[model samples]
Target: MTLRLQPVRLASGNDDSEAQLVFAGNALVAVLTHLAEHHDGEAGRWFMEAWFGPGYVLNRPTFASLDKAQDWILERLAEV
Candidate 1:
């Protein structure tokens, strides 16, 4: 399977607007938001804002980078 990421700005009503739309092939699989400075220790991490399809539910909500997030997403996708 192929995974793609599209940069996006979300109207999340907070400083955490910078995000990425994660797609598995042509299907959107997840939305990952960048944690804002207000998040303190968690700031600058990637947060799983949303997920779709089977086996996408997150056991961990934060990732150190988009690559890590995608790795986790791919693992879940593969499980289905």
Candidate 2:
């Protein structure tokens, strides 16, 4: 099966609205990240999240911006 990272609409009742992550497939591979609210005013400190295999893992040293976060995620995805 091929892995895909497509934009998805956020469903209500979800905990992280600032960020959305969803995945489904037979191989069990996923990626997740968030623009945390806590870093709303912080500079050069953005909280990003990641989902590997069948679980979740947060990347260290958050990104500087949403663009950076997306770039980082894409880089990791390329490795998989």
Candidate 3:
């Protein structure tokens, strides 16, 4: 499948403290699974919520590149 890359960020109290990189697509399930396997449960859960929400549904985003996503996150971080 031709996949599109979208970037998402998770913020807690402020934009800076809890930021992450989220890859969206059919491939995201695989990616999230791998991340869950490698990272702590809390971190994985937070990402899942930000990207997939409570029902594990995809959220629409504007950016389509990893770099763009990271950049946006960093910019938000700077604001906090």
Clashes of each: 0, 0, 0
- Candidate 1 residue pairs in backbone clash: none
lDDT of 1 by residue, 1-80 (tens): 87899999999899999999999989998989999999999999999998885864646489999889988888888887
Residues 1-80, model 2: lDDT tens digits = 33445454444344344443423353323333444354456533444444554324544546666556556655655666
Backbone clash pairs for candidate 2 read: none
**What's the TM-score of each model vs. the native?**
0.91, 0.39, 0.28
In terms of TM-score, how similar is model 1 to the real structure? 0.91
Q: Choose 2 or 3, whichever is better by lDDT.
A: 2
Colliding pairs, model 3: none
Error (Å) of candidate 3 at residue 67 is 0.2
The CA lDDT at 59 in model 1 is: 69
Alpha carbon lDDT of each predicted model: 0.89, 0.47, 0.36
Q: lDDT tens string, model 3, 1-80?
A: 22344444333444223334344343342112112333444332333234432233355333433455445434543454
Q: Residue 44 in candidate 3 has what lDDT?
A: 28
Q: What TM-score quantifies how close candidate 3 is to the native fold?
A: 0.28
- Candidate 3's displacement at residue 19, Å, is 14
- Among the numbered candidates, top TM-score falls to 1
